[model samples]
Target chain A: MTAKISPELPERLVAAALAALERGEDVGLRALARDTGVSAMAPYRHFRDKDALLAAVAMRGFADLRDQLLAANAAPDPREALVAQGQAYLAFARARPALFRLMFAGHDGGPPPIEDNAYGVMVRRVRELAPVSLEAATLACWSAVHGMATLALDGGLSPDGSSVEHAALKMIVAGISAAKRS
Target chain B: MTAKISPELPERLVAAALAALERGEDVGLRALARDTGVSAMAPYRHFRDKDALLAAVAMRGFADLRDQLLAANAAPDPREALVAQGQAYLAFARARPALFRLMFAGHDGGPPPIEDNAYGVMVRRVRELAPVSLEAATLACWSAVHGMATLALDGGLSPDGSSVEHAALKMIVAGISAAKRS
Candidate 1:
């Protein structure tokens, strides 16, 4: 019976959890196990607890977000690429609000590490624009983009299309460049 | 019996709800009534439901936030005043994480009207600086400041003092100004 257990159980659990989040249902290990048609105890084999399972789901969320950012980074002009990335960030948040919220819920006093994820992608582009003040510029760009994503999620932003988002991103990019020159 | 009811019951209930949130407890009307030592049905007289009660608390949060922004806006330099406002926004979010989240949770589509709240305060400052593209500039500034505050709460931001936040706010201000010039 042990040998019969599928090696893909972990992936299936994660997929089920993602689906649960998409449906706005609370994701618990036991609930995921039931959703995945596994024994209640089966999930414990892969995840130490619910937090670990949710962390895996968040990891997958980050990976998907990174892919979106990478695709958005294809513009030839560095500034255009950066703006595209910001747009992609907002789109992802709007498309997967539950997952986006979970991704940044901040366990242990901070979000999961970002060096190898979407942050890294945006940071590289910002470095190209503001080499002199890389840290501040990167943080500024991220704060503006992330803020826009959050505000959109909570409906703090106007529903007047992406014009405001577009303009805001351009301002941050331009601001960083100008500050660097000065 | 109606005359025996305390006129301040509603205020007491709101205070109890605020206390519950501060202690990281879920704010249910019944629970708040219990905490306030009132009959369960008594709360219903003042609040139609839990959301109504919570909305009142969120309103108080906004009022407190607006006051902080107002106080921060007293700097003599327009630029410095704006930066101080951003700092105050971040401080408010950090000081009251639960209340801050509740305040922006957005019901019926958008956050409570912003024209008469903290947003109105910031928008006035942004208008003073970037009068040309007033709408875009205002959104950009709000997004940056709000983003920094949210990130700080979720541990997405580094805990390295306020330098990064300061720089980010400055970059946004400069960015809006540069965009206006060009």
Candidate 2:
């Protein structure tokens, strides 16, 4: 009876992993367990190993990014939508550089195993916004926003410094809009 | 008899380090020496240790980036100049991701050590074009361009197996131009 009451172990495991990421875990099962205040052995029940746990965390991060993109895309104006998306992307990176690093950091298991992850949702968002071929539009939008966000996360662009990220993001929005218009 | 023909040993050592970086040697002086065709004992003659060698490599990357920016800024028109600068920046990243990584790998050494390197040149190029505060203009331009370069390097923006670096770069230039006009 006690074991059955724990219930929905996968979601709990994912949640615990994400919380660990937010708290600055280094994308390892050991760190995740440490961050979650759980026994390292506990994660094994839900995930096969460290790779499985990382995949789950990556999936969650992608979902979070996709949701943020969707919300921003639904904004009243196209320009505002783009700006909000850029800001949202940057905010996520700043709030979770550790996870952000894992999302792009080298993976030993070949091409990222991110199927059906946030990338698809992101592409869908781009498709909804621009009528161009999904390939061109996704590449265009992703490069612009991702590039802007990466710079912000690294020391290249500082929000607190005189060279604030807001101005750059505004230009990114304007640029995307102008490109679409042309 | 043996001291005859080599140019400045420091220059040769720095050149060896850069060459190692160019060949995509992963970080560490031993790997660099192997890539540079220098003896294992060679680097120590110029750099006090591996850290100093890495600093030289990073400094060189910045210097190269700065030179490219200056060349781009010298283009005839503002629009042309921006595009040129953007292209140059992207090209540098593509040509040297390993060195690029070393320059921003978050070492304990403060950025101030490398601030006067290529990054300074990039900031100065921005200062030359904008009427506003140099710090602000520099940040805006750096964020946009550096952001784009980073995404390109990380494969974050790849879609449909296409390289959209140039297209995204055009948007960045457009954004910077619009900001300047405003």
Model 2 interface DockQ: 0.30
**Model 2, span A25-129: residue lDDT tens:** 445666666655566787798777776667667767777777776666667665566667767777787888877766655443423523344456455545555
lDDT of 2 by residue, B1-182 (tens): 34334565567666766776677655566666665556677778888887777776677777777787777677666656666777787778777887776776554452532356456655555555555544444555566566556666766544333345555556655656666543
Candidate 2, which CAPRI tier?
Answer: acceptable
What C-alpha lDDT do the candidate models reach, one value each? Answer: 0.81, 0.62
Worst window of 10 by summed lDDT in candidate 2 chain B: B106-115
The segments of candidate 1 whose C-alpha lies over 4 angstroms from its true place after superposition are A1-7, A26-31, A39-45, A109-115, B1-7, B26-30, B39-45, B107-110, B113-115
Q: Report the lDDT tens digits of candidate 1 across residue range A1-182.
A: 44455569999999999999999887887889999888899888888887788888888998999999999999878899999999999999999988987887664532453525689899889888898878778878888888888788776776665886788789889998877542
What does the lDDT read for residue A52 in candidate 1? 82
Q: Could you tell me the interface RMSD of model 2?
A: 3.9
Clashes of 2: 2
Q: Provide the clashing-pair count of each candidate structure.
A: 0, 2
For each candidate, give its TM-score against the true structure: 0.88, 0.69
Residues forming the 10-long window of minimal summed lDDT in candidate 2 chain A: A106-115
